[model samples]
Target: MVGREGVAVAKWLNSLGFYAFVLVHRFPNSETGAQAPLDDGRRALKIMAESGLAPKGISICGLSSGGHLGAALLSEYPQVWTSPDPEMPQIEFAILGYGPISTNAAGRTIIENKPPLPPKEKQELYDVVQPDVQLRSPAPPVFIVYSNNDPVVPVTNAYRLAEGFTKSGAPVELHIFADAPHGFALDSPKELPVSKWPVMCEAWLKQNNWIE
Candidate 1:
């Protein structure tokens, strides 16, 4: 399941009896921008393995900035976590929301969290934050979702992620909603139909045997 930064969807995962881990380490407090969270994902996954939570494999799901880190965990594992322990669980599945995957500031049509023209440090941050530059081999299957009306993350980000997946011969599913906002499913449980995302997610996981 995916949600905003610090939303703690892991609690719901635990209530369902699935072992869950939340990523609490990152540079900027916000969910968007830069590579600090990718840096944090390494440590988080390491701890998960040390704590015996990610053994055979693990599925990652995220939103916007979190989604970017999720993608980094899968495709750019080499960069994110440099653990000498090759036992790091391979990311089996990833579900991404409106996130900027590979491309960084200079690569995208819409740039975020910066001035009209990016300054030096911000540019350096974007450069290092670009996942496309760090794409590694043997990528895992992915499900990507995006909305055209999302003011924060535009539709192109999803398109680029799919493109990278196909180019690398990785399995991928891209879903586009015509008019949902940036954090459309923020509180989906209170709503109907859309709240069924968890159901759909479970069905998908079961079909793949990721969860029994």
Candidate 2:
């Protein structure tokens, strides 16, 4: 789902002179489970650390499901998700675009409706991946963007995440567009104010010193 958008963002970031990497992971199918993407993300970070690309802390940016994955990486996770290497680079900040932070709310519907898994099984999966339940204090700063008209992921997800960050004393910035639909990405029409999200995100990154 995110492949094209991810590559586009990576190219744009690279044009701005930032070293960007797009980590691809397999999607869930009849033969595979859904947890592989999150594991892939952790391994990607570890690889970046090993490659010496991020001597300083690293920042993450994600769209849609990728955004959900980013939230998991930032929030507290079970020991199974923890890095074995103690010297792993810290996450300085995160940018999430239409991420579904509350897995119980967003996930329950999908799991119950799409999969054949029982309620008990769905609950267990939600326990492992839900960002809202896993949020911890002193988390890295976050910038979130969403559209009220988004039919895919509700704007409430943005509000919940921003609220979590505020309560945890982590810096947060949120922008809610009035009319853009879900998965607008960087292709938002010029007339729609949501098209300016990229500029706003870049400004946020500069203000936080994540970008020069």
Candidate 3:
């Protein structure tokens, strides 16, 4: 279910004079496997590039599982992420909101109820696609946001990703909001400081020259 928050974020970006594309995909279950979502994300990027909307570059912004897919696209497919068809625009930056970048760690918690895979297979799966494991040097700039009070995905996932990006010498900005629950999105309580994430994000984007 795409919430009003998602639409609000898109509209906010549009107001900032940025073209926003929201890509939605079916949940990756035991039958579909994890690769399906990644493929879907790639197809969306391809379509956007071919559409001629973003010629210089594109910035991806994702929340929750969407964030995970964005990270996978950037990390696992470095060749495509870094150097796509000359006709296609490259991914200049990414904004991730409460993403579980480490599949293994998240599997133990968020995906524990899903179909079970053997230890070796799980490890192999993580090695191939987990954003934290797949992170490399010269990656595109990343902006990560998470809340310490999140009850679903652990806050550590965000820290781990930020650490990995820093270790790889990739430009990264991290924001840890206190007392906000998971899935807050743009609907976070007005009383909470976390509700200002969108404003902070805009500042960050402008500072990085992402917005012209």
Best candidate according to lDDT = 2
Ranking by lDDT: 2, 3, 1
TM value for model 2: 0.83
Tens-digit lDDT string for candidate 1 (1-212): 23444355666556556787777754543344444556567667767767776667677777777777777676544444244444456667777777766445664546555342244533445555555445556677777777766666778888888877767667777777676667655455444344555566667667777768
The sequence of per-residue lDDT tens digits that candidate 3 reaches over residues 77-122 is: 5432233332324678888888767745434444445444454434
Q: Is candidate 1 or candidate 2 better by lDDT?
A: 2
Each model's backbone clash number: 0, 0, 0
* Candidate 2 local lDDT, 1-212, one digit each (tens): 54556988888777766889987875543343445566577778888877887777677888887888788777665555454443435778888888766635434453336443344433344456777557656778988999987777777788887887787778889999999988888877899999999899889888877779
Q: Candidate 1: misplaced stretches above 4 Å?
A: 1-8, 28-35, 77-88, 102-104, 111-123, 189-195
Model 2, 132: alpha-carbon shift in Å?
2.2
Best by TM-score: 2
lDDT of 2 at 66: 80
What lDDT does each candidate get?
A: 0.63, 0.74, 0.72
Q: Which pairs clash in the backbone of model 3?
A: none
> What's the TM-score of every candidate structure?
0.76, 0.83, 0.81
Stretches of candidate 3 exceeding 4 Å from the true structure: 77-89, 103-128
Q: TM-score of model 1 relative to the true fold?
A: 0.76
Off by over 4 Å in 2: 29-32, 79-88, 103-127
Clashes of 2: 0
